[model samples]
Target: MILQVDELGKMHSGKQEQVLFAHVSATIEEPTRICMIGASGQGKSTLLRIIGFMDREDQGQVLLQGKDRSKWVPREWRKQASYVAQQPVMLAGTIEDNLRVVSTLHQSVFDEKLAKRLMERAGLTEMAWSKPASDLSGGEKQRLALVRSMLLRPAILLLDEVTSSLDMHSKQLIEMMLMDWHEEEETTLIWVTHDMDQARQCSSRLWFLAEGTILEDVSTVDFFEEPRTQPGRKFLGIQSVRERKWSGEGINYV
Candidate 1:
């Protein structure tokens, strides 16, 4: 397994203690494309934060490459994985500058050629290389965030609704980029999206979260065909056959 979470639990202390997830466990093997789907505020983002190490779990252990992460340095883990937030957080400079600032890898390790290639692949070759990040379109900014994270060539990538606000063309571009990465590079991808159609396209597996728990973890084929849980069925209602067909593979609801 490339990544594993065992009996993970987290609770936020606020006006009321909010248990984000409890006793949650999952494994991500190489080349796994797992899509996390659920209603808004269902803790999909929170789960990503926990796996990305941005937030600590109240209990349980996270293992990466067979080693317990609690015993290892977080900075070391970060080098092996990266998270792209829902919103792009760019710096006050050129696109390259923004990447440089958020880059955790060495400058010598940076592959300028590969970066440019990824930018081109993401459909931003025109304005991505030299344009100031502040002036880029929303889709361009999202693509930049993706390319910046790819600079690390991380073994695992956590994406939270990276294409939520994009136009259909932009969304298709992002989808194709991710599909290429999964097929060509075998990158372990974990994405959270409210778009069921997008989720079905990019993920072979589906993980449904609701009320701070993973109600279903199954193949996307099975989840859509015959959802085993109430929440899973409810979430599926957000997309129709026409939209699910965008995956290019008809849903095998059986």
Candidate 2:
């Protein structure tokens, strides 16, 4: 398995600890695309954070390449399973500085060519690399953050609504760019998104979170066709056959 999430659990710590979720398990046999879908407060982003090593789980473990997360250094694990937050916290300094920060910290040569290519793809070709990253708008910052993460070329890319801030055109560009990147690099993409079109565009498998656990883990076609649980069916409102057909393959990211 490339990555394994074995019976993971977390709690909201306070006067009374509340169980967020438990016995959550899944395994990635290879580099492929999977989308996690659910309503808000399902611990979707929390799970991604755990997998990326940004947060520790209260119970169970996350494994990458047969090694448990506890056995690996945090920095190294992050390099392999990079997380891109919905609201990105930009690095201090120029746009170029943000792009090259990962390589600098990792003591690896920065891929300037790839950075430039990604910036262009993100519709940031006109943006000055010398400009302060903090000066960028929210949408621009979101795209910049994504470009920075792509520079790491991690095996598993953890994305939490990375395109939520972008305009429709920019969103489409990113979707296309990421699909191309996934194809070229064979990277495993685990994205948490409410945009069903976005989820459908980039995934083969869909994991539905409900009732404090994974209610369904199945192929996109199967889940959309007939969700096993009532919550799953409720999550997906009534869509016609033609609309559901797009969920299968008709809607291309490109």
Q: Write the per-residue lDDT of candidate 2 for residues 132-231, one digit (tens) a residue.
A: 9999999999999989998999999999999999899999998988899999999899999999988877898999998888879999888878787768
Give the worst 10-residue stretch by lDDT in candidate 1: 101-110
Give lDDT tens digits, candidate 1, residues 14-100: 526868678788887767999998887667887888888888888898898889875768876876767888887887789888667
- Predictions: Cα RMSD each: 6.4, 6.8
In lDDT terms, which candidate is top? 2
Alpha-carbon TM-score of each model against the true structure: 0.87, 0.92
After aligning candidate 1 to the native by TM-score, how far in Å is the CA of 61 from where it should be? Answer: 1.5
Clashing residue pair totals per candidate (backbone < 3 A):
1, 0
Which stretches in model 1 have alpha-carbon errors above 4 Å? 13-15, 102-107, 238-254
Model 2 pairs in collision: none
Local distance difference test, per candidate?
0.80, 0.90
